[model samples]
Target: VSHEFKTPINAIEGYTMLLQGEELSPDQEEYVEKILFNTQRLSGLVGNILLLSKLENQNIPMKKTEYRLDEQIRQAFLSLETKWTEKEIGFQVELEEVKYTANEGLFMHIWINLLDNAIKFSPSKGTITMFLKQEQDSVKFILEDEGPGIEDDVKSRIFDKFYQVDGSHKAEGNGLGLALVKRIVDSAGGTIKAENREYGGCRFVIELPKQKDEII
Candidate 1:
């Protein structure tokens, strides 16, 4: 089902990219960008929907692998170079060496989705900070962004599927990102929460069981 949707969306995005490279008036260029953006969004939405259904139905296996946690987070950050660089965003990453046994591919999505969310809401020339440490038998990860913090009322529902932050121009996403994050965390026998940072913006914390512990 996702492939059926993504095939056409990919073609539209490819054509839109070609249009972007062509000479055009400012207005035409803006229109091309809009087309490309929407097409890409549609592609992501399709994949997220499929992933959500798979997780919800327990169709995925409980396979686990031992991997370097810090490296995984760093790679996720590098993968989004263009997105952060476009906004002149700087990262202060402080990760400790830690290894954990888990489904590597599944956990990768958590970092990527969270980083993408942080970058999307970050201000121009802002700084994003990431911290990772082993707490007793578990690994703790934190990501802080410099953007508008969630409102008190809407904060509780941020992880609800299709729930976007209300009354903000920056709340334009399809809102599946955090919901997917929550589902993935549950599958890993972990807990994730969000809070408004005292300084500004939002902070996300994810705590996972020790490598020796049993996984769901």
Candidate 2:
């Protein structure tokens, strides 16, 4: 499997470097750039695959600690600033200062992936609202975007592995982001849900039990 993976990546890097150094016409450069971009994406996909493999084999370890929830979210936004900036999407943050216990790295991945999806589906120049509230027994985290809303038929199966929305989107994804998000949240003793916003676009709500209880 390692040989199977490394071969293509080595080939791509060799070809990409050749294309970059060689003198090519403007049109050819554009085409080569696309190839390079996609090659990078493939590299990232390979990394994700290796990570998933380690996770499946239970080789990954968890390090949990107590931290402020809103601060974690702010860090997520800062890390993902490029994605939002490129799309020119505005964000509405309504997070209150609250502390929670969890593996920060895992939750960072969860937020970036979820927020990236929200920003992708959101319309250009549209607003994405993030709400954090304390409920009776848990904390509610809501991320709502202003993109084309999810169809009723697909909503139920959205979290299923490799289940992309059929026919409407041709976007490049292995459809693993949400699935990973769901799994991580579940393992953390939290719940995640997605729905079409009443006004427009898609909304993802995650409920996490407060760390004070610790019983999960």
Q: Tell me each candidate's TM-score.
A: 0.86, 0.84
In candidate 2, what residue range of length 10 has the lowest lDDT sum? 166-175
C-alpha lDDT of candidate 1 relative to the true structure:
0.89
Model 2 TM-score? 0.84
TM-score: model 1 vs. ground truth: 0.86
Off-target runs (Cα >4 Å) in candidate 2 are 2-24, 53-57, 213-216
User: Which tens-of-lDDT digit does each residue in 192-211 have in candidate 1?
Assistant: 99999998999999998876
Model 1: which residue pairs collide? none
lDDT of 2 by residue, 1-216 (tens): 743786788698778879888899999999989888777767756766665566567677878887888888899899889988988999899998878778887788788888878877788899999999888789889999998888888888887777887555545676777877887788788999898877878889999987675432
